[model samples]
Target: MSSAQVALLPGVQQFLDRQHGLFIDGAQQAAQSEKRLTVWDPATGKAIATTADANAADVDRAVMSAWRAFVSRSWAGRTPAERERILLRFADLVEQNGEELAQLETLEQGKSINISRAFEVGCTLNWMRYTAGLTTKISGRTLDVSIPFPPGARYQAWTKKEPVGVVAGIVPWNFPLMIGMWKVMPALAAGCSIVIKPSETTPLTLLRVAELAIEAGVPEGIFNVVTGSGTECGAALTSHPHVAKVSFTGSTATGKQIARVAADRLTRVTLELGGKNPAIVLKDADPAWVIEGLMTGSFLNQGQVCAASSRIYIEAPLFDTLVSGFEQAVKSLQVGPGMLETTQINPVVSQAHCAKVAAYLDEARKQNAELIAGNVGPDAQGFYIPPTLVINPDANLRLTREEVFGPVVNLVRVTDGEEALRLANDSDFGLTASVWTRDLTQALNYTDRLQAGTVWVNSHTLIDANLPFGGMKQSGTGRDFGPDWLNDWCETKSVCVRY
Candidate 1:
């Protein structure tokens, strides 16, 4: 499209015009060393922003700020009702600034403007509101004790839930804004001060949101954002002695490292990690409906979603028809820059990621997988790859077993629901899976048997703030969303008194 004809999202240009910095002590500050990372516009494969590259010194400063805030009770000392008010106000500010945040996310992260608006900003707002409601509900129960202290003395026992002091949250490049919200909001609601380490690749949206948070009347040092390479800042934040809890969302390898570090300190940890999720289409599933579910499960957000269904298992009876339908849909997608309103498929996060996804295709051909759709080629100057589907790649191949984390999927044929179930559970990842079928009995049976944290029946990747979302096994430990997340940030203390 010509420059004259290009339709840009509101505030896209305005966000691109400014220089962003890190958020610490409720203010925007530059890196102490005057270093910056060149953030890429993956859509155009151009440098759009220079983000402050926080070093160990910066991480220490943010952690100290959070510790002071926690000790002083700037946020944690407030009554739950007051915290709720501030958080609800923060949600309001997020809603008010939704357009700018969405546009900024689309520019930096290279996701569609529609998705940035709906999922990045809109869903974040809902999650914030949901968490805000949980603030006043963080309570403990009174218990009766069967003990006597000093001859027939009455005893009372109760428990109290307290914030785990300072929290460190590390988010990934994909879904930066949404995942950042996932980390910070619940911690803040629980009255714990936080230091956020966003992916160096996409730090703009998090920085801006932290600014909005302060504007919503959150006290200083309650929420801080540090931007830099994971090796330096992320390692420093997770290893810092002052951080009482660590909440990280990224690769399983990184999550393991964080776990090891946090374990040394005995710090509370919650990790939402990687997935090579499967989508199983049972024999009773309709081919047309199943194809739509497959597309959404496999390719939403250009297939960068961790819970995105990358491995597809189809019952033998429905294999031919479902595969043909999926191929047609994949071929019809429009791949281009997110700035164009007409584009359906956007570029992957970077040139490096694009190459990683491309290599999988080369290996698939060598392994004799049937390439049903997509082509590996550079689209203009952007890091674009067409939505791809391969049929029956060897189950043991890297493309089949590992997370491609791009717009690519593998289709496998299974004889029955039992075979499909066996193949689906045959993986190191147990993040999520989807079972498409009209048979309610079969769906329930598979739901009980699937090793994943969440199994969708006739749907995929549908998330709600009320429902818990996380992975089992190597996918990661703990959960996000729902009331369970609130509990993870708090420590239960039991008190006993004799009268």
Candidate 2:
């Protein structure tokens, strides 16, 4: 390979340095127990590296370290402004190393470097910077009241946002760096110590982030990383007696499990789980714009996004036009190595995920759903599944009901605008949805009853650091971005003063 192509691959030394093992007390160390996990590059089906996979024993050490740091004067005694400065520096470090982190994410997550650089790493920087500013701004308001029995008596009561103790942040594989930042940045900004458990498949970038965070002046043990499986280390973190909170971003099934374990000790939790989001296209919508929006919304990140518009409802009047445009858009997408700058759609995360998506396609075909474009996959070599589109898909079909988390979209034709809205809300998952209509009145009317946390009009899948992101029903609870995100890791305590 040429120098240019070598530059595209992950720097071996950087990868080894970052992917060493559990990061605790400001140092990288092996797991307490002898467990290991093999990381892979899904784009080429190659083994990237092996790292220490922490179990319950490792989780105990991490949580204890974090707890000690949280209560110690070294971290908890620091003023909010001081914490803000360190976080701002950390954000700058992330931006300075954005290219390297983007390459690691592309190598591990099987996402295009274009998408990783433009979206994932960019979003991480924005979140870190945004949260850095929010640290000093987190405050409570005072309330005035008079005693009913004693007219002369008065009450002065106010609330303070205090940091919860040790927080365990278990992030998913998709958008690993961005989601990991979402879980830890707000906690750190709120003056809480965190033990992050990055998904085993995509731990390299997150481990790199930990090093940068410490180098940026975050106190030792204030931010730790434990790379391991969810069943062991993740469960231990969530159920540990000392850990004050658990914030997880993964499947609904796993979220339920975590909630059950957290409930045992009555620990606080914020779960950002799965989504089978929908996109509703009304009759008055612009076909060109709506089609483009749907294509990007459903197929972006190879459709590995939790809030990706997987289920789409189009008005019958413009269904044919939208489908035709969508087919052309998918056909025009470039699928290749993630390091390639021009590739739009890369391989799925792993062979198992590719197989699951292929099964859905096969089942959809057996049930008589029409394949609109792209269903070519079944290879064990690279785990590549072409962006797939299914027309007139049944609502009960697995492809429509389940979260495929791949580049597969199901299109359903509705009678009208009202029917479009009705069909869109039929699913159990309601993370996000989009309305593509030129009529302002129709867009506003539809937006009011979308039943999802976010409703994008004339566009789709556009996220910002200032907006709160999460789901309503099965999509999961609690927000990930904005000032509100800080509330998830901190508890509000009311204090009263009488003079």
Candidate 3:
């Protein structure tokens, strides 16, 4: 694989020159205590920055700042058009700093610069612009009613969507910039204040986003970022009394814990958690197309994507052929540093995560799963895991049951479509799944039986800003994007009057 082309932009030094610490109440501030944590560049395993480690006291300050902003006239009392203008300006600012933001995201999160440019930065810009249009469209509904007490009196009732006050937006590290936008932009569009606690592994892009948001004329305390470990900062934010809601994106275990904490205040919560997604290949499907789809689905973003198709089910007739073709594709993928234009597969997020994946592979081997190809980690300073495929996986094994969250896939064969549906729905997770077939009826039938939130007929891992994205069952609860997402950030109030 080719080495990355590291051409730092002219303004990057200036951007990096700015304080790289917690942003509280619209300004860069030191941690409540003097403690700090190092941020690493996963591509090269180098320390990029040492950010302040916020504690409970810092969480108190940030949440209170956001609470004050939520109730202040400058934020909560602003007209929809006024809010729209700020959001539009924020969108423009994102575009202005698009390249720099994309570079920071790639350097910090271990995603390819190409993906950061195209998906992360591009989607965030689009989301801000889209939510700007939605701000003015948030209207109340009128209802006509009858009054029983007085014969001459008529009643009027209506419902309006109002911001739910201070929101704790706990974002995941997988797609930091874009997912942060998913949590913050919609709440801001609905006229709420937000306190973002980004994942410890990838917090730089979010802090930079908050900086740009303040620059775009968002009021002080309207948007804040506090970075620290999940146990310290994350738990505090969720349990804080002033936090009206918690928007979290991470693993199922953490989401459950957040849900429990939020229950104390009965605070609303939106959780986008883990997935052990599946992809089904029919007998008559073309080998070339199936191979391409499986390769992209199983290894995209080094398979760290939450909705990636990790568990593959193929019909018995074509099982061996599909596995063989997929092994070849995985073997030929270009794995290297993320900034390289020619690199297809980048390193995993960290050395610890690489070791975790290695342990999973070892477990699979002990359980007698057939390793198809590519178990070799790159011999370098980075956290690299070669794309690996295991065939005829044991249904009860950890690799098949739990989320591997790496560039690893397990292939299994089924007798027919019925067995395929049974095996696909057998797992505890049901986030996303795909079915590849030329027959439309078979596709529709299979989709109906698959237990997941989003079902792709012949594709995999394709997401749009306008579609509702989340999971069913143990995967997660609540949704992101689409029209329903506005409901996730706001609460509905009913008003009735008699005249």
lDDT of 2 by residue, 336-393 (tens): 7787676778889888888999899999889998987654335434778889889988
Please, what is the whole-model Cα lDDT of each candidate in the order they appear? 0.87, 0.85, 0.86
Worst 10 residues of 3 by lDDT: 372-381
TM-score of each: 0.97, 0.95, 0.96
Model 1 lDDT per residue over 60-171, tens place: 9999999998999889889999999999999998898887887788888898888888899889889999999999999899999888447788988899999989999999
Tens digit of lDDT per residue, candidate 3, span 1-499?
A: 3345867687765665555677888989878767887778888898877777889999999999998888875786989999999999999999999999998888888888888998888878888898788888887799876658777777889999899999999998889999999888998998899999988898888888888899999999999999999999888888999999899989999999988888867999988899999888899888888888778888888999998889888999999898778877887877777887778888888878989998998998898888866644446558888788888888778898899999989888989878888889988888999998989999999899899999998899988878888899988888888866677777899999986
C-alpha RMSD of candidate 3 = 1.8
Ranking by lDDT: 1, 3, 2
Candidate closer to the true structure by TM-score (higher is better), 1 or 2: 1
Candidate 2 clash pair list? none
Q: How many residue-pair clashes does candidate 3 contain?
A: 0
Query: What TM-score does prediction 3 earn?
Result: 0.96
**Candidate 2 wrongly placed segments (more than 4 Å):** 1-6, 9-14, 17-19, 147-155, 375-381
Q: List the residue pairs that clash in candidate 3.
A: none
Best first by TM-score, ranked:
1, 3, 2
